[model samples]
Target: MDFKELLKELKGNLLSLMGSKFDELKDESKKDVQAFLNASKEKLERWTTLLAEGNITVSDYKWLVESQKDLVVLKGLYAAGVSKIKLGHLKNSILDTVIETAIGFVKPNKDDDNEATV
Candidate 1:
């Protein structure tokens, strides 16, 4: 896929994942998660705009990819930590699936069907 197609697909996938899976969070944590989703979406928008404006260099794309990889790591850690701390308030499996979905967008595998884990 072209860079623009990839970016649009990734953004749509992420927003969908957040919408479907974020409801698994506790009432108190919902706002925090929503805010995070909003911020991430905005960042994606900025990146898209930069690419569309021909302002993005190869180095910038490389940095963006690396940052996304870093985000996957952070998501893994957050899932683990929050799953433990929240106990019954959240479901780790759902969050894990969401993380996997997001990661797939960053480093897509044509073999995977993008199924959510139970």
Candidate 2:
């Protein structure tokens, strides 16, 4: 078609496309993002608790179960260790170590770095 006709056709298509219904998708996506953000916030709060309070609360039990699945002995150690400590008495150094360990930090092997020792 001529340039004028083509422009009119394109404009009409654009308008029709923009007008199509997507209310449900918008609402669903909003809910999904909101839920994701809320969950993230809760996780941050849990981590904060871990830092501020060495003793684990019930809310953290699920996370311990899920994240420590492969490290049964370690999980047991944490469970036992926390049990003996009163609430809010967790040492800052211990919390730092836990956070570091959870993020995959490990001590250098003695063979690799002789200067580093237990």
Candidate 3:
């Protein structure tokens, strides 16, 4: 899987994770999302390669994503009166989207144990 393409798709998926109705949320959170993508690009590349090579599981990906929680701050949303519960949901949604999108992009390259027959 192309890392650049994966990043692009992740950006779109995360920006729309709250659905179309939350336009304000989308607009307000775009910078935060970009910031995350920028800061996480290298780490994501490594983990994605691991994912594609069957070196890591979805659970591992979730754990790695969670480790970057500090990078997902949403000052704009907080200032916009978005409740803590909703903000938490959005943050969770972002992390969930990252894992889901990575899974969708990178298929495990595991080979069959048995040899092929003619």
Estimate, for each residue in 81-104, the C-alpha lDDT of model 3 and write its tens digit: 888888887788788788878776
What is candidate 2's lDDT per residue for 34-85, written digit by digit as tens?
A: 3322334345345534523434532353354245222222232234343324
Candidate order by decreasing lDDT:
3, 1, 2
11: Cα error in model 1, Å: 5.3
Ranking of all predicted structures according to TM-score, beginning with the best and ending with the worst: 3, 1, 2
Backbone clash pairs in model 2 (N, Cα, C under 3 Å; residues 3+ apart or in different chains), count: 1
RMSD of each: 9.3, 23.3, 5.9
Model 2, residue pairs in steric clash: 54-90
TM-score head-to-head 1 vs 2, winner: 1
Model 2: lowest-lDDT 10 consecutive positions: 68-77
Model 1's lDDT to the true fold? 0.44
Instruction: Please give each candidate's TM-score.
Output: 0.32, 0.19, 0.81
lDDT for 85 in candidate 2 is: 40
How does model 3 score by TM-score? Answer: 0.81
Model 1 over residues 1-118: C-alpha lDDT tens digits?
2545654554455445445555454443444444444445556556545644446643454355346432332243255365544433233332343344444444344233323121
